[model samples]
Target: MSAAGIGELREGPLHAAVKDLLAVPGDRAEVRVEGFVIDLVRADGELVEIQTGGFSPLGRKLDALLDGNRMRIVFPVPAERRIIRIDDHGEVLSARRSPLKGSALDVFDRLVSFPSLIAHPNLVVEVLLCKEDHVRAPEAGRSRSGRRRRDPGERRLVEVLDSVTLDSPQACGALLPEALGAGAEAEGFTTRELAAALGVRMILAQRIAYCLRAMEVLEDAGRRGRAPLHRRA
Candidate 1:
């Protein structure tokens, strides 16, 4: 899917999740946070902010508010997206995790989802994971003599990526599938699998996965016997 198409896919699900989370007991009706105009509400007496895009100045403002009010920020952290810094007044409240590591968004999502998180009196941050599609090499077809022929769709995807600029790993991942002419149903490659296939380091492979996940092109199959596997709507 194109970037715009991916955004469209995220809209409904994200809105529903935010609405449901806000509707829980002790959760206040959705309201705009002062100054930033971000949609937010109080849940269990703690502020909950839903963020979708990057707004550094706005994040800084929210961090400042955390010093005075109990808050929990819920946002989608794009795969491989950098975490600049979170400063709560004079105290540094949070920092981005290591570069080229597993999804930062996934780590952030796990943190706030913990049962004990609601007990905290201070601010909390949660990131939701969204899967992305995969990019594959062009397919080869057999000729009359059993010779292989190149696929046009495969060439198209690569051409697209080569023609544009990519700002992040997520962007790279998103482009790759399209560039390589891999459709949505293409057998997706896992981080480990892709790493082994490409002869790259595990960290690099994971970063690529993170980007694809954030773009909603790949899906995570959660641990067995834990959470049920993620499914597309």
Candidate 2:
């Protein structure tokens, strides 16, 4: 990216790094085709879109892209995060790694945002697990030597430590605490039970439930009190 075009790119360091990694043997970046700017286009015309956010926002863009291209959407998960803070005086404040790490299961959080899109034959969801460095700028109005409440406030990607892929729905089974049954499924589970089973937060479990349900990995089996129950589909 050039100095003038730097602002034109919507993605951050993680995205750009993954794009380079995903650029296949004969793929090209920033290709203009049919008046649309594609991320990467393979020699055989397959397109790749690296999305690190929710899929719901890309509905219209996908609609346009899929009309003519067989595409794949790559999502990067911060499996490990390291924080680096900088003060207004351009001094490095602190560097620390987050104790709690993310996993393949974390993809469920974004998948719940637009579940049906993954069902498209022309589109595949690729999850990339990555170690990252987050750089933050100091919050405004604080004295150079004074202690601040939040410290550096605005955070952005400064580097990518490493990244690897978990491609296809089959590969994502590692995220589940238990395997989904093959048949119409005899027993069902709720978000609460799932949270307890996985030893994760209830809110995260809810998102995982939504993704599994959408993927046809789980089926709705009425409700347990106010929450919905799901069985293997």
RMSD of each predicted structure? 20.7, 4.8
Residue range 161-232, candidate 2, lDDT tens digits: 444344444444556654433233355777787788777788998887777677677778888689778876
The list of candidate 1 runs beyond 4 A from truth reads 1-13, 32-38, 55-57, 77-102, 105-121, 130-233
Q: For candidate 1, lDDT tens digit of each residue in 74-119?
A: 5543333233332334333343443442243233223222323223
Poorest 10 consecutive residues by lDDT, candidate 2:
177-186
| Model 2 misplaced stretches (Cα beyond 4 Å) | 1-7, 139-174, 179-186
TM-score result, candidate 1: 0.32
